[model samples]
Target: MVWDDFAINNLAIYLLDKPNKDRKVALFVKGCDSRGVVRMLQDNQIKRENIYLIGIPCPGLKDPKTAARGYYKDAGSVPEAKKCEECRHPNPVLYDEILGTPVEEPQEKDRFAEVNELEKKSVDERYAYWTAQADKCLRCFACRNVCPACSCPDCMFDCTKPRWLDKEVSTEQNQFFHMIRVWHVADRCIECGECERVCPAGLPLMQLNRKLIKDINELFGPFEAGLDLEQRPPLTHYETGDPEELM
Candidate 1:
C-alpha cells in the first residue's frame, strides 16, 4: 500500500496492533512518520526489535486536496502541504535503513506565529475567537483520528460507561473535547500539523496545539516531542526546581 501525503501517522495504528509478536514488519516512512515511530517507541506502544523502518528524506509534499481542486495545471503549482511548510525535520531521525540523499532542511520559521498573535488578544477577545471556532465543529473526530499522539486503545470520547461527552454537539461540548485532547497531546505532539490539515471545518487546530507547545517550551525549557528516545516529556518528568507560579 502506498500513501502519498505529508503526514503518515494515520497508519500508525496498524504498527501498534501487530498480530504476531514474533513477526517483524517493514514500513516506509518520511520525516513526520519517522517521528511518529519514535513516538510509539518512546510511549512504549511498540518495540524497536519487532519493526524495520525504511526512511525517506522528504523535501516536502503537496496537498492532494488542493490538487484535487484542479486549479493547478502542474504539481509544482500546487502549494506545499501546510504540515510540510514549517517542517523542521525533513530527514528521518530514526530508521534501520534509509533511502535517497538527504534534502536540505527548510529554512526555520516561527512555528507559533498564530499562537503568538492569539496571545496578544485580551482574555475575553481570545475566548470569543475560540468560541466561534468551537461552534463550527461537527464532532467528526477527524482531528483526533489523525493524531499519532491520540493512540489510546479506548478513547474517552467513545466511552459509554462514563459517557464523558454528551451525544448532543454544542459549542461547550466541542470546546471541552478539543481542550481535553489538546492538553492530552501537549507534550506528545510532534508538530506534524495533521490535525489541522484533516479538519473539514477548517478550524485552526494547530494554533491551539501550538499555544500549549509554546507555553510548554517556556515553562519546561526548549523541548521537541518525538525526537529523542532518551528524553522524557516535561509533563511526565519532575524536578524540585520546576516553576510553581500558581502555588
Candidate 2:
C-alpha cells in the first residue's frame, strides 16, 4: 500500500485504531517508525506472523522549509524539517525487501560537531541560540506527528490533568516538549531523522537525538535498533554481564 502523510492523515487513525480487515498483511517501516512496529509487537499490539516490513534507505529527511537554499546547484526536494541534516542512521537495518542500494556510512559521522561547539559557548550564548530557535517554533506538532517513534495513545501534552505546556509557546514549554519526547523514545529511536523533517521552525533538533545515538554506540558497545527483526532493542533487553556504561 502506498502510504504517505496524505494517506496517513486521511485514514491512519481509522485503520490503526480499528482494523476490521481479516488479514493483517504487511506495512512499510522507516527506521524510526520501526520503533513503533517493534514496540507494537513487544506490547502484543500486533502479531508478528501476519506482518512484514518494506524498508527504504533514509537520506536524512528534511524539514520542508529548511530545505530552501537560495542558490544551490542541486537542492532537490526541500524538506520542511531540520532533523534531516544531522541524521546518523540513513540506512535501514531490517527489511524483507529494500528499494535501492544501501547508503554508505559517512566517514565523518560527527553530526553533532556544530552542537558540541555550541554547547561550549557560554551559558547565555547557548540559551540565546535555543531561545532564537524556540521563538521560531509556532508550537506545531509537525515534529511529533511525523515521528514514527511518538506512538503514545495520548501524548503528555494533551493531558489537561497535568497541563505540561500552556497554549502559549514558552521557552520552558518548548524545551519540555523536546525533552519528554526524546526520553520517551530514547530506547527505541532508530535515528531515522523523521521528527526533524516536518518542523516549520528550523531548530537544530538533531543535536538532541544524535546525542542519544552517539551515547548508545559509545556506552552500550554499538547498538542499532531495527536491524534484526528477531532481536529486541538492547536497552530494553538485559543480561547479567552487561557493559559497565550503565553504572
| Every model's TM-score | 0.93, 0.68
Query: Can you write out model 1's per-residue Cα lDDT over 1-247, one digit (the tens) per residue?
Result: 6655524343454676648335788877788888887887887778899988888888788777767866878766888887788889978888889998899987878998888899999999999999999999999999988787888868999999999999999999999999999998989998888898888899999899998889889887898898887898888678998877512
Best candidate per lDDT, number?
1
Q: Which stretches of candidate 2 lie over 4 Å from their true place?
A: 1-23, 29-45, 55-92, 97-108, 230-247
- lDDT score of residue 49 within candidate 1: 93
Q: What are the clashing pairs of model 2? A: 62-81, 63-79, 63-80, 63-81, 64-79, 64-80, 64-81, 65-80, 81-197, 83-196
lDDT per residue for candidate 2 within 114-183, as digits (tens), equals: 6577668898987787777777777888777755455666888889988888988888788778777777
After TM-score superposition, what is the CA distance of residue 18 in candidate 1 from its true location, in Å?
5.3
Displacement of residue 153 (Cα, Å) in model 2 is: 1.3
Candidate 1, which ten residues in sequence have the lowest lDDT sum?
A: 4-13
Q: What do the candidate models score in CA lDDT, each in turn?
A: 0.83, 0.59
Question: What value does the lDDT take at residue 211 in candidate 2?
Answer: 67
Give the distance in Å from residue 193's predicted Cα in candidate 1 to where it truly belongs.
Answer: 0.8
